[model samples]
Target chain A: MASLIPLTAPDDPRIDAYRVIKERDLVGRGGRFIVEGRTVLDVALSPRNRFTLESLLLAESRIEALAPLLAQAPADLPVYTASQAILDGITGFHIHRGLLGIGLRGAEPSMAELIASLPEEALVVVPLGITNHDNVGGIMRNAAAFGADAALFDFASCDPLYRKAIRVSVGGSLMVPFAREGSAEAILDRLAASGFTLIALSPSGASELSTLARPPRAALLLGAEGPGLAPHILARTLTTRIAMAGNFDSLNVATTSGIALHAMRRTQITPA
Target chain B: MASLIPLTAPDDPRIDAYRVIKERDLVGRGGRFIVEGRTVLDVALSPRNRFTLESLLLAESRIEALAPLLAQAPADLPVYTASQAILDGITGFHIHRGLLGIGLRGAEPSMAELIASLPEEALVVVPLGITNHDNVGGIMRNAAAFGADAALFDFASCDPLYRKAIRVSVGGSLMVPFAREGSAEAILDRLAASGFTLIALSPSGASELSTLARPPRAALLLGAEGPGLAPHILARTLTTRIAMAGNFDSLNVATTSGIALHAMRRTQITPA
Candidate 1:
């Protein structure tokens, strides 16, 4: 069982990490990230996730409700409870969910290491220049849902560990293995050399998605919303189109990921 | 050519509909709605869409660049040009896109009328209790991209015509044909009577999406992010699951729609 530390003042030094959280640049806070709400916190505390808990801040009323989760935390990790007003003051926002956790991001596997670790038959999602945090989160969620081996991001893409992205992903950012390293071209070269069929999604592709034969090992290359896959990247892969109707040319990139992943999942030729 | 009316004041009576647009309940604004950004405005002005333009507001600098689109508008329609500051003052926020339009929402066909108008072989998406305007917009965008015949929303769902939804959809709300009427049960009943196969997407569904045969005419029923389809609704339809690999149960409802619609489209059998 975790020890409960009662916090009466918002300025308490131990709770300083939770202060004005919305304003703080929490993304690369010396490897620290804020996990919000009960649902996401549950995932953060799970033994399977690499995130290390620094402390937990909760509303007094929520402690009893979240006892099971608190019990799961390491005994050394402090669980602090405060009045709703003090909690709100400490966070500089009304945390309606009344739960916030400070977590230390664990070391991520290198791109080469991640690729080397993949199974003989694998499905991977490569997001290129996907700058929107929400789209990043949504893509991570889709990657996990479809059981893709990993999500590889180019340097231009936003950090999946951004708080908003993590929340949008419903803690998927932590659950799904991901790595951001190298330029788009470098990553593509590595993927191709690794015997992965690079399928690039574009409106002007050579074939409809349904007509394409499934590759033994495949990587679906996706781009940001408006710009889509860059020309060089599109030229390097087997281009495929989703066959849209009407004048609208695209679906949200995250949605596109889900559809493409599902289609790829169907065509996956598992080894005998 | 649309006539240019020079507007110098924010309080001009002619621009009343554009005043405090952010605060105004633009949805069902007595058959009036606001259209923002260049892309969406282009759709709103299209002859193919039912929206009738009340007026077009443009930043003085933008008028020259948008000459082609302005020319597409009816000659009698009023086109107002104002300085960026004046346009911002009128809308109670930055009109960064430098384009806004007040459009009169045309009559929406009844659910029965809409179903009757669909092609013999059609794909439709029904969103139940989907109150998020952005989700409604995203779903509409996906519906259009995948060529879903129409989107039917239950009365409890938020209006698709809402301004934010339109922007998020990249003006898809204006392009896609959607209607909000009846309760969940009523809409499902209508769909069944119209020779549509009702397939409710749920996490605990019995059959995987890949195994399901495409019905001649299919309607994919979706629920909101949390508190998914009510148990009774799931029991009433042929339940299907989007085989998830991770511990997560579902994708974002809009993303789910895109994936399901894409699956349905592949199996579509067009009549001779």
Candidate 2:
């Protein structure tokens, strides 16, 4: 059985990994991401995923409740019990999820390898400047659902592996094979050379989404919520814009990706 | 000319509307929803929205930058100019967006009225238990892009007017005519009565999305991330699920909504 170390003080060295999570977010240096709450922890522990649990924090009163989940983790993963106050102090907020797990960063698939592995006729989503990790995660999750072979992030985009992103994605970020492509222009060029039907998403420009037919192998490229794709990239690719009903301007980046993927699926006559 | 109101303290009564903006998210009673950054403010000011500006907060140095936008607000809307410190104090954070607008909430469409108003051939998404207003907002934005006539939220969902949800949606929430329909079962029943194909989204069950052909007057139902549509609702509606390529269990709710709406549109196609 894995050991359950009881931490009495907020400053206990054994629980340092759980300390000041917010501050760590601010610094962008909290090695390994935090998965808070029980449901997220449950998803993280699913047999399909291969995550290494660095530690598990459980409220002393809830040890019995977490017994089944603890058993799922490998024997080496430690379970830590602490007072709610100490847990709160360490996290800088109330631990509403009542459980926490830290998962080590895992191996990332190479861009070339991921592409080479896909079926010859594939739908891929290349994300640009989508700095919000949740947005990236959601995009990947949707891409996965729609049968997209891969979800690629450009260098300017946020790390898809960020803890909250993975958790928000319900662990799909890990399940979907994603890699970081460098920039909008470079990726666009690479995609073009790759015989991809490069489609840039913009609210203001180009062919109406309803009228556009899907290409055999396509990349539905999306930009961040606001500035959208850089003008140069938009100029270089086939642009498809969703026709808004009345006054609405744009959907959230993630939502836009969902619609685009869905549209691509329809055009390709694939079940989404 | 609108008057420039200034206050130096975070506790000042003049700024009470902006107090505890973060904390007030729980009860959602007070605390002004601050839409920071210029891009968001730009969308809020579009002539087509229901929201109207009540006031503007501008840094002295930033006044010149906002002259054109400031000129667009009606003369009655208060334009408050203050030192950075005073604006920060009142706002409870640094004013990075350099522009702020206080908008008066507007009346929402009644659910019955909204339903009656839809064209016989249309795409409508009824979002349920989607307490994350941002996701709802994002969904609306996609709905608009995908040519859906409207988006309706079930009563249990979060207020579309919540600040973060609005901001995350890129102000799409305001542009889409969203009504708070209190009951999912009631609305689902009404859609069925109206001859609308009510498709409940779930991963594990129902018809594959691709097989559907030319469905007219449809409502794509979605729940929040994780819990999805309550099983009771799922049991009652026409079922359809997004097809997946890998082991990922689900898609992000907003993305799922987008893909579903797009897929449903295929069913909306008229044989040409």
Candidate 3:
């Protein structure tokens, strides 16, 4: 039987992982990420990821509701139950989902290992500081769906496992292979070295996507909203601008990512 | 001089245009839409769209902030000033943007008229359901940037002008030519009749996008987030698919639109 730790106070040392969530940058800086809501935690706890499982915190009344998942946990994973008020105070944010899990940054894969994992013709989503967590998650979800071998995050992007990002993705973040590599340019270089065409998405580029006679092994590069592909990156990439009808400026980064992947996969014009 | 209408109560008959937003079907049935936030309102007030400026509601304290925009309103438009309490009471949600405007829906031109308003081979975004208002807005923004001539929303889609949709779209909603039309089939028929090859986006279907030899006068068909283009609609037109990396399922609709539009325009690919 798994041991249940009981906490009566919000500030107890046992529940430190759930503290001051509003200060996520500080928390992220410490090299830890919070997996919120029961669904996200449940997926993370699955055997494939084993994920430290650091601790599970839930409202006392709901402990039984999560019994099946709890029982599946490795014996050493700690389970903590606390009052709603205590959980609420400790979380700072509303703990409506009534559950939380903290996981160490698991293992970091090398660039070559990440590249080797991708299939010969891979579509990779390289996100650059597209800070809206939902957008990040949505992009990752699309990346996984459209045959992206993996997702590579540059320095400016948000953490893939942020609670809201994970929720918006419908648990896709956990399922998709992702890494926080340092610079987008460097990642592009690595992809290019591995025979991937770095297709930079921008509004003011010269090539239309339809005319390409052969789809190159490609990496669709996207920048954050407002600040599109950094000039240096754009300069180094094979630029293709998305076609828009009359005066539209740009699609949100996440939406843009989905469209790019779909186009990258086309072979012939089949009449729908 | 613009007159100031003081509305201390939520049910004031003059502000009827801004009521019952939570229930969108009713609003759609009524043949109207909502525009919130100062920036969107400012753009809606532009002479180009010439939106029927019904009234303006400003938090009493924000009057000074809005003085310049007020001066630009048609002389007959009324401005309503209300206390923060009354403003919240009126919108049914917390009024964060501090200013709101009610405008009659812009006069929608007939399909032919809308088409004639643009150049031949213009880009357009055709949204189907796409329930997430933010995605709709994001798509419109992309449409604006990629030079799409207009944004056409299918019958089942959420109102593009809904407060959250417009706010999330970052004012792109107002800058683009947009209107909600009937079913996707009906719209495609109209487009085909006018010489457009409607390219319906799908995950599992014909043709890789990169291999297309020629660009067509086309309309990109996009569906909502999950269950993409219905089989019936997918069967009716030129089904164009993007070739993507293997593991990804699909791109965000807005992204798909942008990428497809970019590809269709052949704006990125250079002659080999």
lDDT of 2 by residue, B1-272 (tens): 45566655556665555555546642333423555557667666667556676567778878778777666666677777778877777766767567766666555568888888888776788898888766765776676656677787788988766766666666666566677767999888778887787777777656777565546777788888777888899888778777665455666677777666656654547432
Index of the highest-DockQ prediction: 1
B133-232: candidate 1 lDDT, tens digit per residue: 8799899888878778889999999888888888878777877778899999999999889888889988887888777778878889999887999998
Q: Candidate 3: which stretches are off by over 4 Å?
A: A1-129, A142-157, A170-172, A175-224, A227-247, A256-272, B1-16, B19-31, B47-50, B60-76, B81-86, B106-123, B150-152, B175-182, B213-216, B267-272
Candidate 1 TM-score, true structure as reference:
0.94
Report the error of model 3 at residue B133, Å.
2.3
Clashing pairs in 2: A37-A97, A272-B242, A272-B243, B214-B267, B215-B267
TM-score of 3: 0.65
lDDT of 3 by residue, B1-272 (tens): 47678887978888776666556622433546566676566666665343466777788988788778777777788888888888788777766668776656656666556755766655677888888877777776666566666777777887667656766665676666776778777777777777766667776657755555433455778898678889888888667666654433445676676666666565432332
Question: What's the TM-score of candidate 1 when only chain A is evaluated?
Answer: 0.92
Which docking class does model 2 fall in?
A: medium
Ranking by DockQ: 1, 2, 3
In Å, residue B238's CA in model 3 sits off its true spot by 1.8
State the displacement of the C-alpha of residue A239, model 3, in Å, after optimal TM-score superposition: 9.1
lDDT by residue (A52-168, candidate 2, tens digit) is: 668888888788888887777766777888988888878887765578777776665677667777776888999988888778878866776666778877888877667667766
Error of 2 at A206 (Å): 5.6
